[model samples]
Target: MDGTVVTDRTAETVGADGTAGRDALNAAAAASAAEGSRSEALRTLSRVFGYDTFRGEQQAVIDHVVDGGDAVVLMPTGGGKSLCYQIPALVRPGTGVVVSPLIALMQDQVDALRALGVRAGFINSTQDFEERRLVEAEFVAGELDILYLAPERLRMQGTLDLLSRGTVSVFAIDEAHCVAQWGHDFRPDYLALAVLGERWPDVPRIALTATATPATHREITERLGLPEARHFEASFDRPNIQYRIVGKDDPKKQLLRFLREEHEGDAGIVYCLSRNSVEKTAEFLERNGVPAVPYHAGLDGGTRARHQSRFLREEGLVVVATIAFGMGIDKPDVRFVAHLDLPKSVEGYYQETGRAGRDGLPSTAWMAYGLQDVVQQRKLIQSGEGDEAFRRRAASHLDAMLALCETVQCRRAQLLAYFGQEASGQKCGNCDTCLTAPETWDGTVAAQKVLSTVVRLQRERGQKFGTGQIVDILLGRKTAKVIQFDHDQLSVFGIGDDLSEAEWRGVVRQLLAQGLASVEGEYGTLVLTDASATVLGREREVLMRKEPKRPAGRPKSERTAKGERKQAVDLPEEALPVFEALRAWRADQSREQGVPAYVIFHDATLREIALSLPADLTQLAQLPGLGEKKLANYGEAVLKVLADHGRLEAGTALEDDSSSSGAESPSGD
Candidate 1:
């Protein structure tokens, strides 16, 4: 019974009173065993990881898995998805085998677990032969509580045979959404994971992901052969993140300004669409005094790993990257996630933005969306390598994203609805639309004018044009392209003189979003859809969100002056120095230990420590996130810091102006 689940066959035996007495006895024994196991799990959680109670659906999910039940858990980032399996693995017998997608982050994951005094190890291609041998020996000897392996490793016979020699308590499939064939981040190797259940029917399995739509959820269940597994769907809403999308205007400059004004010196990620864009944006931010690094598949693996390591270990560093950057990132203090380009789909957008505010503090999800983004995305989908059905699915995803961008309603509401969840209210008061509602006006004439220009280019000129040329022809601009094509002679020319270039682009973009227009070919030439006829015939009235006269500024409620972003956190003035001192101490510990700072102590834990000003180890143990092991390891050091800070406060004012700087933002690691 060494943590291994053993089924009781006593119910199969019949007594003199038939099977009733035996069945009742079996039921009582099973119930008592389950209760005992749950109590052990709770103790393990507190003693190893700190945390008096489980969060959200953690206890239920863990209990079911501990009792030998398969489960599919869909929880948001920083929602403690790891504990759902971690606790059970500790409560049950043998080692927890975690199937991870990010081989590079395995070291950090295992390091974090080890810091909690849990015996954790990982075997991946990155490990040398000696390292793999040591971990394998540990697992076989039952010295390791958890063992992590890449999903691809499961296909190797050697790896499979190695697992057979050790008792596996549970199989945890992390980043489980990768099983979806058409998901935003699909890995071909994940499809092979269905073998775990086939091979070991007695061991419980749990598939966990931070992002997945209803369709992706079904795909995961079907592909992973977990139809009978209990599904635990938590709310996808991350209320701590404020969502904002502004029309692109000199996008690089716009991004620089946004960083300077809102997230100066904050730890964040800026996502671009191309490798070139990632490099250029990183350079621009560095030039403008925003410390940023570039990350994409184009970069060397070592460089990418170095940058990721720096972003994880350092504070107030931004990593400008393509979609390849964040998948299983466990950093808890990232303040914002900015998008320099529009994501191709809502799922991708949601997943990327979800990387921010993982610690549940206030953060932002900003994007510099533009008409060109819409056009470029459409062009990519049309020219992408996929079947008609794939293209249709891609188009549908894009439409949902575009709808979210253009919606006058609550952005969070629309996003939640896309994932098949309803919002609690119409206005969340945390998004750009709710903060400063945009005006939606009738654009029937504008839509008709733009559509007529497309018609004139096709019918009269017998040529197609992109948005720039179409916009020029409507504005009656005598540019070289227009004069070369003699586009000014058309009847539609000069009819749109009332609108500026930006306004015209907005009209075209909205039309495309509403399906009144379509983009075709590699050039992104405008084309009319069947829906255009009604608008041109005055039979349909188009409602469009009016573009603000300028890019919308930060909401007044959340706005702060340059280098004052830390004011958003409602900490007392006296506790600021203590928090900064703890951060400094933690930073030193991280650098000395060669692990991420958050692994030593998350910002949330430090903030609580500062607020409570724990006088001794006993008081410190009462706080959240401080398990028995962490207290024994660092509890005295924390108490010493508090004592020293108290003495300094008693003697002097402790007026450290640098403590309030932007680099010390509330969410800094």
Candidate 2:
């Protein structure tokens, strides 16, 4: 027998109208049955979620778990990872227990599930004793289809005992990368989750994460004690997100310009390295007419929560934050994610940037990188709290990120390659390098000059200097520091005057990236590496990317122009007004319900509805995402909006009301 079985008892509950109540359906689907069948799963999916079919590996994953098999799934963000466990939980008997790291988002998660008419409940620190007791009662009685618990809750004997009392259908560990002890988002509590298998040997477990490299994938399997589980790794490519990195030149100004020219009035995120930077960036954006808020660990928990809530519930609000923000964000319409500072690793960068365009709309992942970013990151790793092996691992991660930044090939290809996936083509035509290729020049002499300077300073003067002093000496600026250090007297000094200061910095940056030099100590002073000898001996040639010149009043790159146009082109001109009207309606509903707008209906769904111009509830039900509950709840309202628009198009004047769809467009497009 399969793990899940829908019994004839459930079918007997159907009324003469051929419709079962929400409770009856949820109970029949979530509780014990005679067998688990794919046909039943499809029926439940269409009836509850309104999707005709599963996407990618969703069907295979669901089948394996429904048949009492464990799984470790690595699907990209926006890749329908939730449905992998969600469908099986509903198909199988008893409540599906989800161990999630996102305690802050449990309410919203449960709310979304409930909106689908699935009986979902949660137990977390946020709930009062009475509220938790009620949920516990629901679970014990098998009245809940799904039960969400934070990973930390599992460590409690009470939580374990409560689970033993209930008939658990399956166990899902979300954000499973948290078990990777060395991962960017490691949660120490996740190490305790392996006990789930020990406690409930028969219950199938599924571990899911949005981002994980091969090593992290193995680590999650080992840590979760799912070594024999079926592993499903989906392509990590988020093709909707266009990746672009620019050489940092007055990065704040560059960011402001990017926002103004391309993504004005759009919701996005700006990441900085420090809390102070986060605050200042948010303030700067606000002052410059961009509605922005700061979020970081420095802020109180309430402030952080409030800002996060605002970012979610309100449209076109940018959240400036440190790395603390964006792990498990479910907002689907973020237009961009800008990094003012370099991220630490390809994995971290990929995960952070993946937050954008979760709705599968055209979005951007932009970053401003420079020589200082490389230096600062190296210095942090050197002085960071870790042993030698940890520092080496950190350095390896940084090296991969730097390589992505310095690559002349397609950015998307390099990113995919880092995760052990191959791109379909050499050029994705969506990234900066593919759209506007940068020029590569031989910088062998430049590399030699920089290395020689380091050698002269260390050997002759027994001293070292940071990148600035080195550039000053190379350009022969003869600044006060140069005069004080008597650096101008060295033979290697002034030899690099042929290149501009910016160009020399590029050389130094590339040299460090190429392992020709290293940053040492607190001052970030440059020192020659073993590879420097090969370059100095003329045995190796250095190929460096020339920084593209951006003069004043320059035109925006074709990539940015195309991204802007792509968003506009998604909706036909005739259907745009209808889409806007539907969006306005959605915003009002979300505000009333205290949930994010997408939780009601995604912009994609609205766009389809507008294009199709569904005339009635029957027609609306034919559209994707209009699940049974959503159709019943909002179908009449949607049809009414279409009817009003139709009348308005025919020039039939209607009475204006406060809830009129004539209000300004809520999406800010």
Pairs that collide, model 2? 5-33, 5-35
RMSD of 1: 6.2
- Model 2 off-target regions past 4 Å? 1-36, 551-569, 652-669
Q: What are the lDDT figures for the candidates, one per model?
A: 0.90, 0.88
Task: Encode model 1's per-residue lDDT on 275-333: one tens digit a residue.
Answer: 99999999999998999999999999999999999999999999999999998898998
TM-score, model 2 to reference? 0.91
Q: What value of lDDT does candidate 1 attain over all alpha carbons?
A: 0.90
Say which candidate scores most in TM-score: 1
Q: How far is candidate 2 from the true structure (C-alpha RMSD, Å)?
A: 8.5
